[model samples]
Target: MMAATNNKEPQRIHPHKFTLWVAMGSIIMMFAGLTSAYIVKRSQSNWLEFSLPFVFWYSTATIIISSITVQLSLKAFIAREMKQYRTLIGITAFLGVLFISLQLVGFYNLESRGIPLFGVKSNSATSFLGIITGLHIVHVLAGVIAILVLFIKAYFSKIKNYSSVPLEIISTYWHFVDILWIYLFIFFNWPR
Candidate 1:
């Protein structure tokens, strides 16, 4: 029996982590720009008075829960518990979907409340709010897609070995986004 030679270590590091961070940083910058624009616009006169969509609160809660689940998944991976890891990942993805659905519901609630979100012509506050949430929705959609990809890789692929680095990376990014949303919510809807 010949001992296996050619012992180059397998490149176990996942490629997605770097890409996800780059993408997430871009997303953070995008949101920061929107929030800055909001600050500038809110300072202007003749801005219509309106309350933020209530669904935002619900969405924020959902994102927090999703972050918790992602953390659990990362812990499971560290513990080498494949079933719990996969289950937690699935739960996180479902929470992502729930977050998106809540965003749409928020838009509907705003419409029902007669808030105008039409481009530049809309009231300054509404316009800024619309842009902020709209960009956030786009990012959330991207996150949902990423979650789906993770699901497919974790469940469907034959790759059973769970890498702790990838799981932690995903959790880090997900938690950052989740916290960002909470900050935005408080900033946008804070009582004057």
Candidate 2:
């Protein structure tokens, strides 16, 4: 008779990964509600329509490029190309900052046109734009912080086993934010 076999199925997701997924789901739901409200409010008589600033287009491109760099960084990490990984991560972080700066320029452009984010004269359209884009910026800031942490850890060789978990998580989050921004940009620009 053979001894009992100790077979185990692979764990597909880590606990931290599960937690991140749950958080992402909540965020999706929140944005869905916000966008739904935005659509419903658009038919109101006082809704203001304004063209988005040109800088927003530049920021959109910046975020898309950052997404590519983050993916490259992940691939480099998996291949154990530490130097390339570090450089890609650094570039991604810089792009994150650039995206934020461009977004600020967009906000300034709106304000210059007298579309303030909040005030008696501020219509729902401008307010929604501010709230939605501001929330996205906060998420991007969190992603940038995570990238910086990973970059620092990689720089100091703190990632002892060359584990891909942290990099994978960061990449997933970065991609999510990138896609979310793209969706928002399209949603805002779409004809009502």
Candidate 1 has what TM-score?
A: 0.83
Best-fitting candidate, scored by TM-score: 2
Cα error, residue 156 of model 1, in Å, equals 1.5
Clashing pairs in 1: none
Taking the tens digit of each residue's C-alpha lDDT, what string does model 1 give over 63-93?
Answer: 9999999998888878878789889999998
Looking at model 1, report the run of 10 residues with the lowest lDDT sum.
159-168
The reply for model 2, stretches above 4 Å from the true place, is: 1-10, 157-159
Deviation of model 1 at 149, angstroms = 1.3
Residue 152 alpha-carbon offset, candidate 1, angstroms = 1.5
Local accuracy by lDDT, each model: 0.80, 0.92
| Clash number by candidate, in order | 0, 0
Model 2 deviation from native, Cα RMSD in Å:
2.3
What is the Å distance of residue 74 in model 2 from its true position? 0.6
